[model samples]
Target: MEHPARTLTARLLASRSLPRTDPQVRRALVDEAFRAELEARLAAVGLQLIDNPYAEHVAVALADDVHEPVFGAGREYAASNIGLTRDQIALLVIIWALIVLPKRERQVNRQKLIDDGQHDMFGQEAPLPHGEEVAGSLSEASLLADFAPVLGHKTYVQGKLLSRLAQLGFIERRGGLIFEGPLLDVLLDYRLLADRIIHGTLGEVLAQAGHPLPDSDGADEGL
Candidate 1:
C-alpha cells in the first residue's frame, strides 16, 4: 500500500479558528517519541503496533481488523465531493470491494462504477493488464496509472490521487511497475492494502472529518 506525506501536518497542528475570548490550546502533532510511547502503551493493551505513520496522520492495524484508526486529530476529511474527489473514492472502494464483498467482490457494483467512457487517472483504458505503458513522458507517469490495468479500471473517472506508499523504505522498478523492494519482502496484509486503495490524501482527510463520502462506493458489472 502507498501513502503520501502532507506538508502541513509536519510542524504544527491546524485547528479550527475561534473568536478571541479564551486561552488557545496548543494542539501539537504527536512526534516520533510520542508515537513510540503510544505504541508501547497500546502494546500493553494486547494490540500489536503496526506502524503506518504518515506526515500528517498515523494509523495502526487493530488486532481484530475492523477499522484502522488514524492518529492525527485536527485534520478533516469529507468522504464526498462533486468531481474528482468522489470519483477517486469510488475507485478506492471498488478496489476494496474486490476483497471485502467476497463473491460480490468480482461483481462491480453499478453505482460504484458508472461507465461514462472516462479513462482512469492515468489516462489509460480499463481492465489493464498486470502492467501497461501510459501515454505520456516518463516523468508524467504516476503510481495510479501504473495500477490502472492491474486493478482493471478502464472506463471510469480517474482517481485524483497520485501518491504511492514507499515511506517504509527504498523503491524498486520493474519495467512499468513500481515496488517497495523485492517481491519476497512484501507482506500479505489487507489493512494496509485498504489505505493504499484509497485515493487522494486530502480527500481521505476530508472524508475522515465527518463529511459526505457518497462516492466511496463504486462498481464494475454483473456483480
Candidate 2:
C-alpha cells in the first residue's frame, strides 16, 4: 500500500479538496509530524496547505510568493484564474456571507461551549463539529427573493452563476436548497473577510436584506 502521507498529498493534488472526515485528512488534522511532512512536500512546489480548525475541508493553494508570477505574468492581475465575471464574483461573495458567516459563528460558539466545560460527561473530549453539524444549508427560493435585486440577472444567478460555483466546489445545489461545497470555507480566509463583510459596504447590503451580521468584536480572538 502507498504511504499514508504520500497518499494524502496525491489526493489533495487530484481532488483539490478533501473532507476532514477522510482517514488521511483526519490524520493530517491531528498528527503534527505527518502534517508538517505533508506541508513541506507541498511547499516544495510553491503550494501551501489551507486548513482551518473551524472548516470541514482541507485544500492547497499557491504560496504567496508564487501568486504574482503565476497569475500576473502579462495582463493585469485577475481576481480568479477561472474567469469569473465581476457580478459573478459579487454573487459568490453574497452566497458565502449568507452561508459561511453564520456557520462560523455557530462553530465559534460551540468551541466556546466546549472551552467553558459545558460538554456532557460522556462527550467531554468530543471533537469540534464538522460538515452539516457546523454548517447550514440555504434555501434557493429565499436567496432569489432576497438577493435578486442586488445581484440582478435573476436567470443567470439562478442558472449559470450557480452552476459555475457548484462546478468549482464552492456550493452544492439540490432540490431548491444550497449547501456549502468542499472549498467554500477552505478557499476563503474567514479571519480576513469576515471583519470586512461585517463592517464594510457589504455589511450594509446584508443589513438591507434583514440579515445583519454581528459585530466582529463579538467573536473570539483569531476568529
Q: State each model's C-alpha RMSD to the native.
A: 19.3, 2.0
- The TM-score of candidate 2 is 0.91
Poorest 10 consecutive residues by lDDT, candidate 1:
17-26
The list of candidate 1 runs beyond 4 A from truth reads: 1-84, 97-159, 162-174, 178-223
The CA-based lDDT of model 1 is what? 0.30
lDDT of each: 0.30, 0.83
Tens digit per residue, CA lDDT, model 2, 52-134: 77778889988989987788776555777667877778878888888888887787787677767788554447777666577
* Model 2: residues with Cα > 4 Å off, grouped in runs: 121-124, 218-223
